[model samples]
Target: MMPNTYTQIYIQLVFATKGRDSQITNLVREEIEKYICGIFNNKGQKVMAIYANPDHVHIFFSYKNLQITISDLVKVVKTESTNFINEKKLCVNHFTWQQGYGAFSYAKSQKERVVNYILNQETHHEKKSFRDEYVEFLNAFEIEFKDEYLFEFYD
Candidate 1:
């Protein structure tokens, strides 16, 4: 039997900063998303969707060879976005991503549904806070999560 050929995989990653002040405005958020996309594109990764709120970000990406680990990809996105924001003088204080991130795998058929959910974050947040939303994702994925580690953006 021949070895199985590599297959492309899609992942949805969610991460936020330590504080709510990280995302000051839409301009800053747009820059961060653009920079992340640019970085991944340069490395031959394809970004399927992206959405940013005042505190966190959701990114969906697909890779052919699976060359990048989730940690490596998160690090690059955070580091590059931070540098780009700083270099452009976009924000006053230093920006940083939280210590951990939430990543979930999805079937190819679910791509559109996932992307739509991400794209409508702004509207969705009107009824649900980021914390609640995050919890929902965790629950939907059936992953165990400690409440203490989950950051609350809205009071």
Candidate 2:
């Protein structure tokens, strides 16, 4: 009998800088994405796509670790990445993530679509503001949320 269990969970995590400040500039965006990827990989998560926008970031990963909950993993990434940015002085100001994040799950069938969406964040944001896009995701997932509880929208 096989002792291993089988499971596949795709998660897309969206988070913005504290106060939705545009601290992640083009110069450090790629480095931040790579660092975040390393954080996910260290936890044995398979990263599908990661993008760092001026004010926010989108991370798509496959979760298989039964030991760590999604919330815990996000917390680790956010905290660690914040420390990394500050330690490395990647930004002009101290770096910090907002209080909360958005975690959306997807079916295996939607993997490619989700990855494409995350990879195209730059182009997508050009047409739509992050606030609108985030609200759309909440509406699509039928998640009831109040504006006050949402990220401090600076846009």
Candidate 3:
């Protein structure tokens, strides 16, 4: 018998830089996005879309199999991006991502909608802060949250 072939899995991930400094500039953002895509490609993952805002990032990707955990993926993105930014001296303060990230699973049917939302993060964030946006994602996903851990994000 042959091993079971896993189905493609789509994930939406959101995370912000440490201290909410809005330090990612246009050129740096583009370079980081390109580097992220390269990382995903090497890992046998497909980055369908990506948008790196001033303070945070949004990514849509598909995995061929459940070989990697979401936490690991987040760590890779964070570490690589930080290293790249530091190497280039892109920002004044050292670039670092917050400790936590938010990832939500979506069906193939919902891909377009999620991509649109991510693409418009600049406009969406104009009316709300990243803290509020993070909470909204948690609430919408029906994930329980402790006020303690959540408040740390704002601080």
Candidate 4:
């Protein structure tokens, strides 16, 4: 008999636009966020919170699918979202996600905190630039990353 398996994984994904342009304006932010959530839901994942900043996005979700790797999930989300945005002409110019993304895992105990952080991205960015915040997250998570390889920071 096959043994039953169970697992819990919560991840917060961070990614920016190709040129780091403030393209995700207020006019299209809500639609884009909802579309992204749909993508996660369709994959059998539960999205706890998501916010699209002018140039970046943060998504917190409970990963339920073991068949797909995190890297593959991120790639699918980015590609589909880009297509959704461009096809809908949500932005004045074409839209595309950057090459890489930051995926930070969190304990179940920290779910509320992560959700709040993602929901408050607008408020949080008022004081801190996306570059500084991303760098801080990398440092806090003890993830080794080269500055050059990080997202392009125009701010």
Pairs in clash, predicted candidate 4: none
**TM-score, each model?**
0.88, 0.97, 0.89, 0.97
* Number of clashing pairs per prediction, in order: 0, 0, 0, 0
Among residues 3 or more apart in sequence or in different chains, the pairs in candidate 2 whose N, CA or C atoms overlap within 3 Å are none
Clash count in backbone of candidate 2: 0
Q: Say which prediction, candidate 1 or candidate 2, comes out ahead on lDDT.
A: 2
Q: Write the per-residue lDDT of candidate 1 for residues 84-136, one digit (tens) a residue.
A: 87788777777766778888999999999999999998898899888877888
Per-residue lDDT tens digits for candidate 3, residues 1-155, read: 98988786789888878876788888677888898888888777888889898888889988764687778877887898789889989888888887787788899999899888888877887898878888888999999988776524543
Off by over 4 Å in 4: none
Judge candidate 1 against the unseen true structure and give its global Cα lDDT, from 0 to 1: 0.81
lDDT of 4 by residue, 52-149 (tens): 99899999999998788889988989999999999999999888988999999999999999999989988998899999999999999999999899
Error of 3 at 65 (Å): 4.1
Off by over 4 Å in 1: 1-4, 22-24, 152-154
lDDT of 2 by residue, 55-122 (tens): 99999999988789989998999999999999999999988999899999999999999999999989
lDDT of 3 at 80: 84
Model number with the top lDDT: 2
By lDDT, highest first, what's the ranking? 2, 4, 3, 1
Model 1, TM vs. native: 0.88
